[model samples]
Target: MITFDQVTVRYEDTAEPVLRGVDLTVEEGELCLVVGHTGVGKSTLLGAVNGLVPHFTGGTLYGRVVVDGRDTADHPPRELADVVGVVGQDPLDGFVTDTVEEELAYSMEQLAVPPATMRKRVEETLDLLGLADLRHRALHELSGGQQQRVAIGSVLTAHPRVLVLDEPTSALDPTAAEEVLAAVTRLVHDLGVTVLLAEHRLERVVQYADRVIHLPGDGRVVSGTPAEVFRSSSIAPPIVELGRAVGWSPLPLSIRDARRAAAPLRAALSAAVPPPVRPVPGGDRPELLTARGVTVAYQGVPAVREVDLTLHGGEVTALMGRNGSGKSSLLWALQGSGPRKAGTVAVSSDGPKSKDPRKLSAAQARQLVGLVPQTPTDLLYLESVAQELDQADTESGVAADGVRARTILDRLAPGIPDTTHPRDLSEGQKLALVLAVQLTAAPRVLLLDEPTRGLDYRAKSELVRIVDGLAAEGRAVVISTHDVEFVARAADRVVVMAEGDVVADGPTTEVIVASPVFAPQTAKILSPLPYLTVAQVAATLPADETDPDS
Candidate 1:
């Protein structure tokens, strides 16, 4: 059990408190989910429970915060290790060991858990978190999702009564996020561990939480059951929105529930009108960027074998596969950040080979390509949002600073602020800001690595729309993402890479609907023909007069 009694936390020299007079309690065996827009102190709230706020961050604190019967001020992170376990958004930054099994056993070893007991715990954790298949993999060798599971598994090895996660699923795809959340839900149902998690993807976790906590940017705590809290707030899951539209009592909590409630309504609507069936888009045109017989190596081992692939302008293409499939490596090569040994990579736009990304001069390369890196904060160094955008605008030379940044931000607004500190924004907002700046550069081809990893459904949709619009403008858009829903909605083509080889390529619907490993959306699976949107489905249904059975 944990309690915050009028708790207020402020960082060093900061005038405003990140947490303002927070009074809340999380009881044993309860799962509490924290949701809010960017810069709402969700991460700060998690810090209070683990004593990382004033201790690690060095801030001013007011009022008493208690966890597991000990005052947070009295017990530091190390002292509270037995009572609380904390996992952060970035698994790479949190990795303490080289291998998966060692990382999982590190905490127990520190607790002086018996060697015999530690071994047993390690095995159990691997099994519980579905890491048995990857137990022998190197930390750097794992995928984003696998690395995240190992991070949480390392903390779970300590057997803390309370598990506090800050954006635990931020780096995961839908399937991976589902796996991590299912494991967390099992802890609450089977092990009775109290869970307090902060995340931007409310639709994925809100249904599982017993209570919901909202922290607006204004510094206040909004607490109640999920339906009660979300009903009063501006944010909630898609199912909740559908519930409001269909008048479902208590609100549909899960997609399964939503589907059930939709069946009758869909039947009634279908009786009146038949659903439309659209054809899949045409095959990709000529390649904008092509790799022929390409091979890459690292430390004497082959990372990418002889492979051939093409990216076309005015199309959205995705690179996907399991962990260690060489998806990221290929992207690096395309960005000219990696060595190319045995093949040639060519772009459609006219340029000298020396002006190519692989061997180009600085200015020449800047005129060719723009990349949104996987880590949102890695490229951001400005003090304020406005300055970051202004610098980007000036370097781009396409438009005036005031004109371009304002246009982009307004399009991406309700989530990002033009005047807020880039560091103070949520992970999703920070990514969007950097991406908006990247778009201003006006490159022929755009490379986005895991673009939707941390964003909520709304943010994800907005980003997809932006990419779609860009593709419509005839820019080659290559996105490396695991969000199947996003891929289904936006991609015109799909490329599958596995173990450094080009395994598959085709139209988006054909590739996703045909692949056995990559799961498509439920609606896409249910409908025989391609159906990406509800509006599309609404327009296709046949009229009631067409069918006598209706």
Candidate 2:
């Protein structure tokens, strides 16, 4: 249904093409997954399907891209809207209507569909994507994950033959992500729709992919079955990596397959002990921040109820929950910057009395508690990376001539050019920049909301290192995220929230291993085991025994 014939895309003032000699074909009723590192032209490849590359993005296309018998070059996005529907990374950017119901119906109205058909399709899509409960909610009021579902439903209502999704499940929680992926799979199998999806979170979608298209960052494309591609691919899901580590022939792509081949490994690990969880510091860990009766509401509707929490020095806590479950609201309220209808947030110190951060100035609040929100770019305003670092130093009153911020940035994501614009940086790099800005303040408590939204495995590993180092320095850190795999690796303690209240709080292994919805893939495969990550499992086995193929 979609064909790219020797396509070479190059922008002005760039010597190298983003995509070079990319000849590929995606058959109808197939779910094609595009995989690669950050900034490797995955978006460029997806944009070519509907003529967004050369037509709207101001690039030059060397060859032709045909979608459903219509050449994208001859038909711009508007003319091909009937055949192709695209959903981008940020859902809010594409929203034109105020409410979920209206956004879903807007596409059909633009395409001149009858009102009755549009209404019927809207209902079907709402049910398909599990948005029936939120049909009347305003777009801005919904959580990020909810907004993403609405964005996808808006495109799905059009009933296009080919669907292009970029990071469709990046913002969704575990169960919600499953629902959306299940709906997309149904479109491919039950309705014969062609889907071309690009996602950085391979663990969530690799098992459902019919084919894998890998961009190696060298302007080259490699296409094959999942097993064939992952056999030599540098980037792979944990399930695939586990299979490789255990020398399982025909590397498993799904958790079920991995479990079937892991009996021996599980038997071997039955008597072995997993690594111990991070120990609480002795002698009563110092209290860094304390909150009491925290409440956040919007337009008479409470998003976060009265909740009391405490942060301790040298501890890393993970805030986790489903979409619209008050995770973000709680973080914002705790940070003292977001609205708090009724709460008192105080930072501890050697002084006789604790300091209420909300009563202090912005600069003073940041010195006690710093927050890196979901969209890290919101914290950035300067034109270049160097200027941003300098501004951070000035704002934070760091007299080290911006050395502290630059040092943090280098440690988080090394080798970022000083002249590069903050907007031009990749998702991971932008996050690192924002993190550096926040850390420069040397807040006793650091809060990160959805930090792993767009990061690949390498970037996430680096982030884990940074978080660990902060904890080692006797600073308290909290990461709010839905990526269970990430939480399994990075978090010391897990706190689950739901419906404006704290539902569960405990050690990471105890909380996640018991919940079916929150467990990582490795934990699922090796049931009755306490392992949370592939690295943990690998650590328990001998080097020679782990990899028979080696």
State which candidate has the highest lDDT.
2
Write one digit per residue (lDDT tens) for candidate 2, span 1-550.
Answer: 9999999999774668999999999999999999987767888999999999889988799999999899998999999999999998888779999999999999999999999999899999999999999999999989999999999999999999999999999999999999999999999999999999999899999999999999988888999999999988979988988887888889998888888998999999999998754444445568888988999999988888888888988889999999999999989888777899997888885578889877889877787788999878889898899999988888888874534788888866776778888987766678889988987876889999998887778777877877887888789999999999999988888999998888899889999999999999899999988888888777889888777542
TM-score of 1: 0.84
Off by over 4 Å in 1: 11-17, 133-137, 268-286, 297-305, 350-356, 381-390, 401-426, 501-504, 507-530, 534-550
* TM-score per candidate: 0.84, 0.95
Lowest summed lDDT window (length 10), candidate 1 = 541-550
In terms of lDDT, model 1 sits at 0.75
| Residue 532 shift from truth in candidate 1, angstroms | 3.3
Give the candidate number with the greatest TM-score.
2
Per-residue lDDT tens digits of candidate 1, residues 461-496?
Answer: 677778877776677888887766567666777888
